[model samples]
Target: MLIGEVARRSGVSTRMLRHYDALGLVRPTGRTVGGYREYSAEDVRRIFHVESLRSLGLSLKQIGRALEDPAFTPSALVGDLIRWTEDRLERERELLERLRAVDASAPSGWHDVLRIVELMQGLDSASAARRQQAVLARPEGVAVPAELLVRAVLAESDPNVAGALRWALVRSGGDVVAALAAGVRSEDAGVRRRAVRAIAAMSEAPGATAVLADVLGDPDPTVRGHAALTLGRRGVTGAVPALVGMVVEGAHDVDAAEVLGTLSRDHGCADRVLTALAGELAAPNADSATRIRLTQALVELPGTTAREALRRLAHDEDRAVALVASAFVTVLDERCREDRV
Candidate 1:
């Protein structure tokens, strides 16, 4: 076939075929009387081979090596091409994500679009400080997309940056409770913790109370404890048992005691709190240390139930328990006396 017929049949342009000849990539194997370039079957096959390699992102020089060099191993070159393709694919995915975030923000102008892009980039930044500044520096009135905020809050590892992202999520509010709840269910303990922290930080995280109520049942004690404490503070009586457990385990017992005290202020839940505490206190296997922590937690409870429990504990067999309970009974007596006057 002549160059024209070869170009027509192979779909390689005439100019490109000539360029290939110049580079000695696919030289014509024949010539006509008019001295025009002619291609034999083997040459045509080589032309198709070059085009096939080019489709895999091989540069012309690389293709030349691949086609002509006997020593050129395709394994290494193909692996490099795979890496390059992956890098390009990742970049495109990131760009698509940014476009989605920007579109979700509903930017009214180029300025808004740029601002949201900058904020999203900052949220994903490697430096914790940059991430924090990204959240804090959001223009006052612009609503940063909630999905971006949710992602940042879930992935943020730095305490300060996480706090700022959570604050931004709360302030930017647009139905983030579902995303946060998903975080609470994450298999990664750190992610679950961050999710709960973000949810608890919201003044009114929609569905947060319900999600946290479920989190109260988490098998991880730390997760359950944090969720219970937050729920207790919110006056959810279901947290009383977990709070009492915290006191028994001596994990964040002080904070748990304080929140339980706050919950006990509601007369409806006070009995439940006192009963849970008394059960832990009276358990036969309850160690002396657990009893001591329980006694401390009782100081936060109101009504005669705790005071009466203290009075019974005052004469207990354990001297340390007697000493602590006796001291508390005296303090309660003094406070009652002062109230009477």
Candidate 2:
């Protein structure tokens, strides 16, 4: 059948089917001799699965990955979702009890305001976790639910959004962060990339440092950069090694460069990052922009450690980079002059 027929049987429109195709949610099985699209009974089955999950609030990108495996279990996924729904329900219940004991329609405090949102289905922990993942998982050009856009905007407005989110991740450290990390594992590159950025920002939360470690090998350089920056800012000294690797692979990108600069500022992390930068600069494939930035970072650091690292990199293959490193050392080398530790 053509896309129109598939759309008719599936109750989804042709344009949406096309969008699904773009998201890899559903694709025709074959093409006709005249170049029209053709689909099979199996394609119809796939569409049914996609539509079924969509009704349950799964994003097209999520449904797309679920369909690739023969062993995929929709019931199990639904059960997980149902559990999340139950948790959200319970939290709202507690919030309501607190609200009723206070004045009519007036929030007693920040927690009271939060409780009202919970009652209205806006601040459910499980639901927020799921919605965040869904928003992060949607492919580029795909439309998102309008309410999500509003919440994301509001989340930014609170100024303490990061603090509140960190509190949530810490308070419910296990499940919420687990769902978010799963979004980062999405096969849709866009989904994985955005999710990783969100995860990176959450590293200060209880379980988040571990979560960022797991994604250090993410396929996209952009995701890795964000992850590296997040971990660096969190100042995970243990993560210094993995972040060092990302910095090497992503030397040309400014995000990684900035992270390395931060790591250099951290007295404990500077040595490892500077050593890693030195090795990367000597390698034949290193980016010139990257080498310069690393050298400049080394020169800019106030610590005696940074100066020593600069001295070592002064013999780099790139003459310009080497000259800068040597001159920086010459200027700041005095700081290390008096019996440096």
Candidate 3:
């Protein structure tokens, strides 16, 4: 195909194609007798590939590297492209939706006036939900609610969520996090829900882990469970206290199961989880059936600490638990026979 045909088929601009040719990013495989650039089907494929990468925000230099090798696995770096596209698309959709809603609601004589004002903002959390209610109610000036606006930013996987947070609220960075932490305790169900989601998305720090622990007290069970999971990922040793309380004292039953499991598997809170396990075995709290299930869980854990905790439980106060551990001790004995325990 000639340049025009290639441009038509590939939707690549003529100027860009020429530039690509010059940079060897996409080269014509053969030349015509008249000396015009002639591209093969293979060239078209390369063009689409380049365009796709560019659409994903890759620089020309980066696209060139991608073309040269198919095995390129820049895991964390490549993830940035997907995150950027997702965030941009979400923003675009939100703005469009707000525009459409405003258009439908504007009075005949006041279309221009409403356009200068926002139509109505997007709802993210209950705080924002309240603002939306106020908007529909008419004549109440509404910026997004503090809780709802912050929740939206924190739920995002993209770092651009940071900008949304900064733009909506003028609070200092410290205050923003503190408010978000405090949001978990909000009486508004939606605010608590979104706040749990937001904090879960930012679980790289121990301070953030404490916030999740605090949310465990939320009346909403789901919020408590989400907090447990977020705390688990950070391996925050500080959460051990909360985990112990949740699992043993029934401080938050829904959170208890998942958080206790996460403490052992993900957070590496060895001592606390083991102590909780031993306490459950030594003194009975979970029913016979549930305790049996927990016995199976402890058996499969394959960690030496869990094994030692089991050994201690083998001499448990409860004869039933001791019996269950004795049966498991038989398995440990066989492993010892193989020298593999």
Using TM-score as the measure, which candidate wins?
Answer: 1
Tell me the spans in candidate 1 whose CA falls farther than 4 Å from its real position: 7-11, 68-79, 121-130, 219-222, 278-288, 315-319
Ranking, TM-score, top scorer first: 1, 2, 3
lDDT of 1 by residue, 257-296 (tens): 9989989886378888888888888899999999999998
Judged by lDDT against the true structure, how good is candidate 2?
0.62
Query: Which residue pairs in candidate 2 collide?
Result: none
Off by over 4 Å in 3: 1-148, 151-176, 205-207, 216-221, 244-269, 300-305, 308-341
Q: Give candidate 3's TM-score.
A: 0.40
Candidate 3, RMSD to the unseen true structure: 19.0
On the 0 to 100 scale, the lDDT of residue 322 in model 2 is: 81
Which digits, one per residue and each the tens of the lDDT, describe model 3 over residues 194-304? 666665665653366677777766667567666765665456555554555454444454455555666677655656666666666455456664555456446644467
Candidate 2 runs further than 4 Å off: 1-175, 245-269, 300-306, 312-317, 330-341
For each predicted model, how many residue pairs clash, with residues at least 3 apart or on different chains? Answer: 0, 0, 0
Error (Å) of candidate 1 at residue 335 is: 2.3
Against the hidden true structure, what lDDT does model 3 obtain?
0.63
How many residue pairs in model 1 have overlapping backbones?
0
lDDT of 3 at 107: 39
